[model samples]
Target: MRAFHNTVLRFAACIAMMLLASFVPAAALAQEKTSALMTPELLEKVRRANNECFACHSEEGVKKPPRADLDITKLRPLAHDPKVFNGSNHGLMECTQCHGQGYTEFPHAADARESISACEECHAAKVLRIEKQLDASVHATRVKDKFTCSTCHDPHVDLIASTLIDPRKIVAQDNQHCLDCHDSELEFAKFAPDDEQTSTKKKRPDIDKIHEWLPNTRVHWQAVRCVECHTPATKTLSHEIVNKEKAERQCLTCHSASSSLTTRLYRHLAKEEQERLGFANSVILASSYVLGATRHPWLDRLIVGAFAAMLLGLLIHGLARIVARIVRRKKNHG
Candidate 1:
């Protein structure tokens, strides 16, 4: 019996050694951390492919600039952190996924195949079949930014058990997920404290505390999904529309209005104000942002031309009226 037990113990030890050999070494894991940590080598290799994209883009550049503006030799680390995207998953994703061809190498960015450089590469089949049902939802549109797939979805820790797919579900889940990060804005910090060791977390901040800060939409937006009000069209990752339309719709929908367009011209952007909006609106008040818009010479010319045309027409009509009145008087006198 002792001889048999000794042989069994030796077999078990050999099996354990083989199992230990199969495990990933700490060094390999550290290398992955280097890549994910945004090390100089990785950043340089990625930046080398397309560096000359900042010629015409006002203040914005490739954080991913377009191919025409790209210059391969001038990539540099940004001095300031992008606020709207401060903690966003875009920080960890690969550049090549969005930037495309020779992006991995120092080649001309113009050679990028615009069509294929989209979410469709991985999700095209799953998305195409579904959007076919929804009449091509906004989710199907190709993205232009230089973020990778892992930006939103953490590739390192994908638990297949709770995979989300539906757009509405995805948005709702994402909104809740964002709240986990943005609780300070919501004043929910009292309840969801970050400490994991003590077991004592603060209570949920009163709805009143929340109400006092946002003041207006705190109650209503609490019930609605955050994404619904903050319709983000770009992958730039900042959603800051005040949902003036939503507030407008709520007023029109409930408070008795003749039409949904009851919102005055001042409430929304004018035709020329389109370019003035985007990620900047996320930080500042909407009204204040509109007030600070830069006026172009063409805009002044347009306004002057409109006034000139209106005055000219008015003068022509007045002259015609005076002539008709004199002719009528002459006829009566005759």
Candidate 2:
């Protein structure tokens, strides 16, 4: 019986040793991989591809005097700053993830099927909302060829919206996006062809001259988004932009007791009654003020009321003086 017990114990020990041996290789392999990091060859390949792609896609790459006859808008070079791109949310992702294969070589083959990724592929929900807004917008209905995501946003240079530290900078950036096409005579001419005109170029509006009615127009443009005036009042803000003529130019739209900026641009900033009203809060008022939106609500009313009272007092005093003068003349004539 003792001999049988010893044999069983030896068998159990052998099984335990076998199990320990089995785990050793996997643990060692994991350690090796962690220590080695990225292979030199792989790093070189990535660097080569980035260099090749940027050569043409970058401002430094493609020389302008782009062919007028050919639709070179897509081919035209818009410089991408590497520092900005690196700081963005999509920075770490490989270029091939969006642009896809065949971009490995320079002067991508003319016939090469460009496999660009769609925004909806990853952000289906956000894209759905934006698409609804776009479908209803004048741009989609009026223009022969509707604008795409790239028309407004450049994937390479555009920083993550949340990453923007300065509110004023964001406002300027937003306005610049509209000005990019609208202010350019070439871009405007492309949008509206002047078949009768010899130049085919349309006269672009001087933004400053057009917005003269707006106090400190250039400063306002740099502080507030164009969409604040262009988009209609809605529960959720969107890109359903209107024509400039249709835009809410009334100063009261933003300066009155019922301003839309609180609901739109300042939505996430402003806080009231324990509820975060807008993006940052009234703290942003330190940087730039939107008349009704940023100011203390009661303080605004107090100022307006005091001004009105003073005006009434002045009018009453003038009327009383005139009446006294009239009475004296009547008495004297009598």
The deviation in Å at residue 175 for candidate 2 is 0.9
Instruction: Give stretches of model 2 more than 4 Å off.
Output: 1-52, 55-79, 144-146, 193-203, 271-281, 297-334
Q: Measured by TM-score, how close is model 1 to the native structure?
A: 0.25
Query: What TM-score fits each model?
Result: 0.25, 0.63
In order, what lDDT does every prediction score? 0.38, 0.61
Highest-lDDT candidate? 2
Model 1 lDDT per residue over 13-72, tens place: 334433432352433332232233445775465344322322212235534454564552
lDDT of 2 by residue, 164-252 (tens): 54557568667778899778877766666344558554466777778788888778877788888888778867778887777887788
In model 2, residue pairs whose N, Cα or C atoms come closer than 3 Å (at least 3 residues apart or on different chains), thus clashing, are 267-278, 268-278, 268-279, 269-278, 269-279, 269-280, 269-281, 270-278, 270-281
Candidate 2 lands at a TM-score of 0.63
Give stretches of model 1 more than 4 Å off. Answer: 1-92, 105-107, 113-116, 136-218, 226-334
How many residue pairs clash in all the candidates, one count each?
A: 8, 9
User: Total backbone clashes of model 2?
Assistant: 9
